[model samples]
Each structure stands twice: as structure tokens, then as C-alpha cells.
Target chain A: MEQPHGPQQQRPPSSPPVPPAAGGPAAAAADAPHAAPRAPRRLSRRRLLKLGGLVAAAGGLGLYRCGLYDERLLPPGLRVLGRREAAIAAAVIETVLPPEPPPSPERVRTLLAAIDAYLLGLPAEQVEQLRWLLLGVEHGTFWFGARLERFTRLGARGRTDVLTGWQRSRLGLARAGLRGLVALVFLAHYRDAPAFAAIGYGGPLAPGFAGPPASAARYARLLAPPEREPGW
Target chain B: MIYTAEHVRRDRVLQADLCVIGSGAGGAPVAWEAARHGLRVVVLEAGSYLEPRHFTQIEYDMVQRLYHDGAARTTADRAIHVLQGKGVGGSTLHNLNLCKRLPEEIAAQWFADHGLAPLQGGTLPALFAELEQLLGVSELGPAQANANNRVLERGCRALGWRGGWLRHNRRGCVGAGFCELGCPFDAKQNALKVFIAEAVEAGALVLADTWAERLEHDRRRVRAVEAAVRDPRTGAVRHRVRIEARAVCAAASATGTPALLLRSAVPDPYRLVGSRLFLHPGTAVAGIFAEPIHGWRGIPQSYECTEWLDLGPQSTRRVWIVPSFAHPAGAAATLGAFGAEHARLMRDYAHMAALSPMVHDLVPGRVRPRGRFGVAIEYRLDPSDAAQLRLGLVAAARLLFAAGARRVLVPASPALELAREDEIEPVLGALSLRPHTLDLTSVHPMSGCWMGDDPARACCEATGRYHHLDNLWVADTSLFPGSLGVPPQLTTYALGLHVGRCLLAALG
Candidate 1:
């Protein structure tokens, strides 16, 4: 039914080269529309194992990372995070979304509560991935594989450094988890009023209307349902 | 009467002259026209009737309620993020209300490739004009163009490119900027307001929270559409509803329509039923401005720069530079930055002006039906399409600089943060097509179930009738032969009208 050879696919037309601007790589890239496909950045299966293999090593040491979050300590809305997991999440988000004015204890509680609610509701697969990401972030190390210090144990600056390192890590798994957590935590914070206002966002399309909806009354003609024939 | 499946205590059997699946742009129009003609019509909508007053414009809430899988709909590989809408109004409820007719070249492509005679022969323009009048397609005025949109226009002027206001199906749009979320002010003339409302007024029975499992069809025609009435809050189905109809039109969407066909076990003679799908994968490059653009305050996507939008056959200049102002959750989802930089990006969310420089993609994809009421979309931005996005980012970065942006965040392979205007090219030029590097998001998903004269190459006829299944028709963007390089709401409406007319003729 199909041919494996020849120009079987219809390729998009090449654009007339964008007139180049002055600048080195960026300028050259300004005209960089159609380039040969480059190889995807990937860590081999061995590299991924190298990144996450630290959890088993910790298990060998009998340092249980499971149930790190305390359900009772979390705000009423939250059910998933244990005390330790909640603390580390709060710490991680503090670095990711550093609030401008120092937050009240209540403010911090609300943001964390919102995050807990979001995490608790994630679909089964995403929850698994989030948990895995949290474990890696909270436990993975700079030394070898995800086997570094517990993230909460690291200083504020150290936490930032560790997250950056993971972002820059060759292992795609580490990067995926890192990005996923950033999005989840980032959105969770923005959903809170204090955090939302900090970013200069106002919820709801401000009810600034010029007038009520006006139909051209295009269907006014069809209102009478004429007895005219529709046959062609 | 609108029936929610959850409260239906018994299996209900309903009948209509025409049964339309999905109540978005496609199904709503057909249902309206048929019901207007005094035909008994039944419309089945899987999503709930999320009315305007209930449209809490909060990004998180809207995504959970309106978007498919809470806007977490993705390709099978979880690479590209799909942004299809759900609910009685379908995606139109959350869509930005861009109502462009099929571009002339794309119309010709359909005629030549798919033998769509109606798209030619002066048929399409008349229908397009009809839709325009009905939907209130207006050229956005200067007042409606928000600061986010002005930034793109300013850049286009600075670069001497053809850029201006886009026409939208809005009546008194007060620039609420939450177009991705449902418009609370009822300013958007989505099908819920226009076609579906009219259809309901004309006595079309609309069933919400009812999921059509499959079409009961023989080799020649669909017998009855079997659906489950469901609780809007819970997935529990309380009753079953069977709608026996003279004709069935699948307008569920580019993804849902084909899935319905496959679920019905409809014969695919050409083996092209759910193949060769096209979605315009877009990537937004954010620019931090010194001035408080407050990009979220006004109408999102009012202006566009079409300088490099070349959609001719085999042409690579396939990019549309459009304004993209995002609500918090929407903005954070496809943001390419991670870690502290992502946090910093959010910090400047107020000053962030983004341009969704999207690519006109041609690489085809597939939509596979998964678990009950679930579908898996598989699409990839091939190297060429990825290359198109790379150039789009370059143009966007320059536009930001021209618009007096302090810094631009380029979501490139080696994502660049350029402060100086001169850094746009070298930084981008140095980057290669790390194929999976782009944060691809698409609102326009088109061309899965194609229409053509040939039975082998195309799935259905230009008349919108399924070739193998006689009485089943398609009335959605899925019938499109290729990408239209523009917002497709108007085209979808006209296609629905065309199909409805054809069906009327066939029934007579």
C-alpha cells in the first residue's frame, strides 16, 4: 500500500532565507529554519540506572525513604504527603518559587496545602512519577547516581545547586522528574492567592465588557422556517 | 431535553432522524441546521454543560473541567501536549475564538488532493460568509488588542512585516484574557451560544454527561448509537441510552471521531481511517519586558505577524507568529525552563509577553482508542517541523527585542536567554535540532479522517459521507485533507453545514 523508498512524504516548502542579523551563533541561528535532524539527547539505559540506582543503595543501608510525608501533619486538604515529604516539598518550592515578601506561617501553610491537594489528586501513573521524582530530589546525590544527601538536609543554597545539577544531568530521567516537579510545584504555588498576586496575575478575565453580546441576527431569517423546498 | 446519564434510572431508548455525536463546532452546526429544518435531532455530548456563570476562570479549575484529561492530553510518547477541550460546547468553550476561513491555498489543496468540489465552485465562500455573519466574525479593533498583542504588532512594524488584527467570533469581547479558560462574560460566540443554543431552541434533544461508547453499524449503515449516561462528577454510569437514527454524523473531534469509528468496528477500505493526522504544533517564547505589559489583562491572541507564514505546497515557510497570553497553569505547563529559571520566569510572569510562533506541520500521526472513553494521540514534530519551530523562535526573539523587551527566553535546544538584540542569531544558530527539545503545544488538530474522490487514498467522499458505511458521515476538521495554517473554527462550521445539507439531500 505504501512505498518505503523515494520522496514518499510531502515535505514543507523551504522558506526564503530570513535576512541575517548581526550576532554570532544567535544570528546564524536566526536563519536556522531547516537543519538536518540532530540526534536526541539521551542517557543510555545504563545511565538512567546510574541516576536512580541510589534508592536501592539507601534501602541496603536500611534508610527507609518510604512514607516520608506525614499525613496528619499536613493541612486538612492534604492526604498524600508525610511530614518529611511535606517539609522537603516546602523547602524545594521555596527555592523554585522564592516569594518576594517573607510569607506568614499561615501563607506557607496554605501554599503547601494547595500543593498537597494537587499531588493527592494526580492520576495513578503521574502520582507514581511524582513520588519517584520527589525521592530522587529529596535523596539523590551529587556524588554518584541519585545517592546523595537527603535534600532537606542540604542548606538553601545547596538545594538550589543540587536541583540545577539535576537539570543539567545527562540522565533524562533525572531531568524529566526535575521538570515535572517544577511544573507541579510552580502551578501549586500560583494557585494560592498570595502567591498568585506576587506574580502580578489576576484570576478571571476581569469583567471589563464594552456591552452585552450582540448577534448579527444571522439566524433571524431562519426563525420563520420557510415552507420553501431545500431540494437541489 | 438535556439528559445527564447519572440520574437516568433505566436504560433509555431514544430515536431521531439524525443523531449527531459531539456538540462542538462540527456537531452543533449540523444539529442546528437539521433541527431548524424541523427534523428530529439528537446530540450526544460527553462533557457536562459548563455554563458561562459557572466558568470560574481560574487556570487550574478550567483545565480540569474543560480540557481533555485536565490539559494533560499528550501523544502516546508523552512528548507533545494536546489541548483539546471537553464539555457540551466542546473545545469552542475554551478556544480563543479565532474564526479564520480556510486559507485560499489550503482550500485549493483540498480540491486538488481530496477532490472536495464544494470547497471550490463558489460553495465554500458563500457558506463561510454565512458562518461569519452567524458567528459575528469581526476584525478586532485597536482597543481590544492588548499589550501582549501590541508587542507583536510593534515588532512586526519595526521589521516591516505584514501584521494586523485577527477576526474572531466574539460579540462585545472585553479582553478578559482567559480565552483558554472559558469566557465568563459570555463574550465568546462558541457553539454553546450560537449553534447549539439555536439547535436547542429548535427542539434538538441534547444529552450531556453521556458518553457514546460506539456506533452500532452494519456494513452499509449505522443502526443505533449506544451510549452510557454518566454522572458528571463520577465516572459511574447509571443508565444506558440507545439512539436509533436515520443517519449518524461523527463530529466528536479529530481524535474522538476516528476513535468512535474504530470503536464501531467500521470497515476501513483504504486503511486511512485514523491515519495522516496534522496538528500545528506551537512553541511559545517568552520575553520579559521592563514595562508592565500585564500580558494577562486583555484579549489573548488578537494580533498576528504573518511575515514568514508560507503554506504553499512543499514550502518550508510554515510558521504563524501569534500572541499567546497564558493563565498561570496554562503558562507553566509548556514552559521549557526548569528549576530556578522556571521560578524566575514565573516571577516575571506579569511582565512576560509571549509569542506562540507555531509551525505548519505535515508529519502525520495516529489516534488510537484506549480504555473506555479514553484515546491516545500519537504525533511527533519531525525534524523538518522542529526546524520550522527553531526559525519561529528566532523570529520571536527578534520581535521581542524590537518591542523593547529586556530579556527573551528562547525554548531552543540549548535554551537561550538573550538580553542583547545581537544575541538572537548566534545563540540560536549554535543550537541543533535535539528533536525532543521543543516544548510543543497545539490548539489546532486537523486532518485524520480525510475526504477525497478516491476510495483507496481517502476515507470518505467530499460529500462527507463515509464510503464503506453509507449513512455515517463526518462533519468536523477531521474531514480536512491537510493543515489550513489558520484557526479552523470557521472552516469546521462550514464543513458541518455542507455535510448537513448533503445529509438532508440524501434523506430526501
Candidate 2:
């Protein structure tokens, strides 16, 4: 394969190993480059995240002139998640919750809007990390063996399998990405009253509640307004 | 006169007898007392004034309005998410009202070890009682224990654990479950409603969306507090206000208090300005029960199990187990699964019940400012604290099954769901205690400016006055010598009142 083109892009070994996401140190050992055993204590999630960052940044090398800065290519009104990233999100969320009744088009738009809002709310560095996560997952199809697969090329079944692989993949980076995206989708869907009602939760009881709602008047006598000072 | 910075059109200077910074649980009581005691008080709050009208009760909107960093703040390395309140009322605006006096032994330890005289037996209890009365502290009624809490309550009973209704600082809380989302019902009696109202009523001035830049101080005392009046929404400084006060009380929380002092170049002779910072980091296990639990429906944190609340100075630390429900935003953020499995778990959202297991920290942490843009908290899990969490999680999982949960979803990174009760022990035992393996979060951040008699040992003195400056006092959770296994709002209120009384005495 042509040596990946970028400052930090280097071809990882032919076989990219997979480790279980749980069982902390034991799982992290799978990601180590060499067979030589090292203390798992020294291998931290922060360090692993940093490594993932490097890999993701490198993955975006030839994807676009500026993979992230290429905003003109995106469908209008979409800020952070462009056509490619948004498609990946749509695919991933659908696969995560493939119910008999798939979410409506409006529901999908709402979820994506929530995600965009969340991404916008992120600190600048985190925003880069999330964007990189999206790009890396997409680029994995091309860079990693055909078995690893790209997001666009994968069928619905293939997409689900890839996500499952990531979730179950001993790589902490893949796990973090999957977890974060899942959160964005789940929260956006479930934060509303209909979501609560579907789950059988009676919504927050307030104005109709029998007890005296916390009123400042309760302590009016004790904390009555003090005599105002003469205009100084 | 009270000024909302949203209306600040130009720069202005204000003067007062005392200046209290950050109107949270720590500052409000002091402001209330100061103004009530005939002192001209000026309060500067960095966040906006989120009243019930402003509180939309929507998760996303509420977080943007109430939470510091918009509920997205994480620890320095992004290991643990930190949830703190912002706006005029500070954290009190949105805190789940689980009120507890500082655990007696922790207070006693401070009194004995650090010579925190005011924290001795009756001193704190009296203050606690006074504040409790004023704040309307009461236990959750049977009606208030919704299905989610009922799960925890029943589970504790099944396990023969000592757990029951939690006392909250609320009055007429009509089970408005969105307590963490800034109670739109105006049910939660936070400082924003009680003390702040009293503070304003009693001839005190509260500058909303105003940030204190520096304590203009010299070797002897703080001369004036220089602040910026900014647009609450944009945080763009629209005006400047310099308040000259006889004394200053820093209640800017554990993070903000130290940051302010460091920014102002205040005296730290003992190098103890930002040391001993503590966040009682918590992780919860969610259970999907057969019945619709609707975890987010009622009072969020109205029940706790004290079966394992071991406060003794022993090898094992105390673990406080409680049902901690979340608004969809926070809940979604911590979910460990992705794809169908993620949807599968969330699909049972009405059936999801969660338990937050927390521990008192032995490993003292510190907070450091990263220039002016942000602050980084340095917290490493003490080995025992980690063990306590593991044990607590196990206990919680077992209790869930005992309460008849179909399955339990832990906060584990790779997604751990105990589908069968039999798998609980084996699965829990297999896990190791790495920092990132769990979804770690902290709602309580305590003890950045510890109070003690020894100038060389602690940051603040017995009366909550800073050892370095004569006119500077601290009346916040920053003064706690250590983490309280329970919620610190009540203790925060009591401590603020205690320090306010002391400062009043000194000033007189």
C-alpha cells in the first residue's frame, strides 16, 4: 500500500488487534504494539485517547483538502456534522436502535439537530476530537483492511457489525466514540415528555400539585423585606 | 439596589460595607445575614438570574441557563464529568435537594486535627438547625417516592439494608422531578429563592451576570473588588463595577474561589490556596425492571441507603448509596452502549432505574487555574476509594435484582448489563478499577480553601477569615476540611451562616 500521506501518517502493522472493552488493564494490553508485557497501570485511558486522536487526525489526511475545514461541501444549515459525518451518525443511530418502527424523518432531523447543538456546545478541543472520531470511523473502511470497512460502503448489517466490533473492540478509542455518539442520540430522543410517557413515567407534577409549591411567601414573616436605606 | 448585568449599558462603580462573591449555597446565607445585621452588602454573581419564569424546565435549555460550563464540564483529563450550577443562585439553583449536616466525625476530625473550633459539636448543629428551619428541611413523603425511588427503597428493604427517605431542603415540592434542571415548579427552596430574596429585601445589592476580576489588595487587607458587568447571555463585558467594601467574602465555589484568589495575587504564605480540593465522584448502575420505573418522574434524589455509611477512621471508607435519576441529557451522556444495544437499553427508559454510589475521598486533590480561560482539577482516585466504589456498585446491582429488575446496566465503558441475577457477582468481580473504566461524575466539589487555626497548615482560619488577608473571609464549601459523603448544601448553608456570624462579630 502507498505509505499513507501525511506528517504523522504511518501504516500500522498488517493485523490490527482487537481487545475486549472491559477488564481495564487486560483489555488495554491488546492495543500494545509489541508482545512484550508492560504494567497495565502505566497505560491510561487519557493516553489511549491521545493515541486515538493521533490516529484519527492521520486518517483524515487525504479525505478532503481540509477534511474538517471543507465546509462548502456540506449540505447547507448543517454546521458541524456535514454530509459524510451526518450520514455516519444517521447510520450508526439507526443500527444502535433498529426497532420495528424506525424513527420518522422529523424525528431523525430533531435528533441530528440535538447532536449539532451538543457539538456546538463542546469546547473547541472536544469539538475537534468528536469530528475526528467521525472521520476516523469513516476512513477505517479504506485504511484498515477491507474487513474493517468504511461507513458509506457498509450495508445496514455491516454497519451494525462494525459498531458492535468497536464496542467490543478492545480499543478504548472506538469504545469512547461509540459511547459518546450513543449518548447524543439517546438523550435527544428521550429528553421529551412523549419519551417519558412511552416509558410510563408520569411527568413532573407542578402547578396541579396539592402541597404548597416552594413559595418565597412561606418565610415572608421571618425574611420580610428590610426597611430600605434612605437614598445614600 | 439590585442590578442585572443583562441591563448594564455602561461602566459603573458601586460601594458597600461588605462584598460577597458568588451567590450560591455558600454566599447567599452570608449575604442574607450580613444585610440583615445592618451591613451594606454587595453580591456579585457570575451567572444570570434564572427565576421560575426563566426556567424552561427543558433539559437542554435549563442546562444552558443553570449549569456551569453548560453541564459539559469534565475533569482536567476528561476522566470525570463535573456538574455544578451557575447563575445568581450558583449550584443551589439546580441541586437535587438531598440535604445533610456535615457528617459528625468529619467535622470532629477537622476540629481536632485542624483546630476548626467553630465546627465543634453544638456550633454546627445549632447552625444546621437554624438553616434547616429557615430552608424547610423535611423527609420525602410516601407520595414523593415515585417508582424509581420505590425501586431503591424496596431493594434496600429486600437486602436488609438501612435505607430510607432522604431529607431535602424543599417546601411543597410537588414531585417536580426536574430539580437538577432548575425547578420550573419553583419547588426546590434553593438559595436563589430564600436567602437571596432576604439579601435583596434587606437593603443588599446583587449584581447579576457580574464577575469579580480581582481583589484589589495589599499586604494588610483587600481594598476593593473590581468586577465586570457583562451581558448574561453572551458574557461580553458591557460595563465595569468596582466595589469598595470594608470586607470581602469569597464564596465562588471550590473552583472559582481559588481561581479568584490566584488571579488577584493574594497572599498564599503557606502555599495552601488551591490545595486539598475534593470532588465526591459518583458512578451509577441503571436497572431495567419489568415494571415501568420511569426513573425521571419524581423527586430525583429523595431516597438513600445508609446501610454501608461507615464513617469510622478505618481501613474501608464510607459509601453512600442513593437513587440518582437524571434529566435525559445527563443520562444519555453516561450511557455506555452504542447502536441497537444502546437503543435496547434506552427503549426501556420507563423501566430504567439508577443508583448513584459515592465515597468520601482520602486522597486530597488540588485545583489549578489554566491562565484565565479555564481551571484544571487534579484528582487521582485513592485505591481504597476505588475499592469502596466497586463494592458499592456490587451492592447496588444486587439490590436492583432484589427489587426485581430484569437486568442492570452498569456505568462501565464497554457496556455491562447483568441480564440475569446470577451474572452479577462474576461480572462485577471481573472488572478492574481504572479511572476511565467507569462513567465518573461529581456533583459536589468541596475543600479547596480549608479552614483551620494554624496559619501554616490551612488556608482559612477558625472564623472562616482568610489567614493571608485581614478583610477577606470564605463562607463556602471551599472551607470544608474534607468531603462529606452526603450532599453538602445544608452544611454549606450552615457554614456560611456560621462564618457570617463570626465576620459580623469581628467587624463590630
Report the lDDT of model 2 for residue B146.
83
Give the lDDT of residue B382 in candidate 2.
82
Residues B305-369 of candidate 2: C-alpha lDDT, one tens digit per residue = 88888775763747889888776556666776654555566677777889988877777778877
Q: Which segments of model 1 are wrong by more than 4 Å?
A: A1-60, A67-73, A77-95, A99-147, A150-162, A171-177, A205-232, B5-7, B234-238, B336-343, B412-415
Clashing pairs in 2: A19-A170, A96-B339, A96-B340, A141-A149, A141-A150
* Reference contacts preserved by each model: 0.20, 0.24
| Model 2 misplaced regions, further than 4 Å | A1-178, A191-232, B141-143, B234-237, B315-317
Point out the worst 10-residue segment of candidate 2 chain B by lDDT.
Answer: B1-10
Q: Write the per-residue lDDT of candidate 1 for residues A1-232, one digit (tens) a residue.
A: 3333212123335745434577799556534655443444577898889867876787755554443443333455457776666776776666666535544456556668876665543344555556667766776755323435567666667777777767666554455456556666656656646657766787654433322333323322222233421111
DockQ of each: 0.10, 0.14
Q: Provide the global lDDT of candidate 2 against the true structure.
A: 0.75
Error of 1 at A107 (Å): 5.1
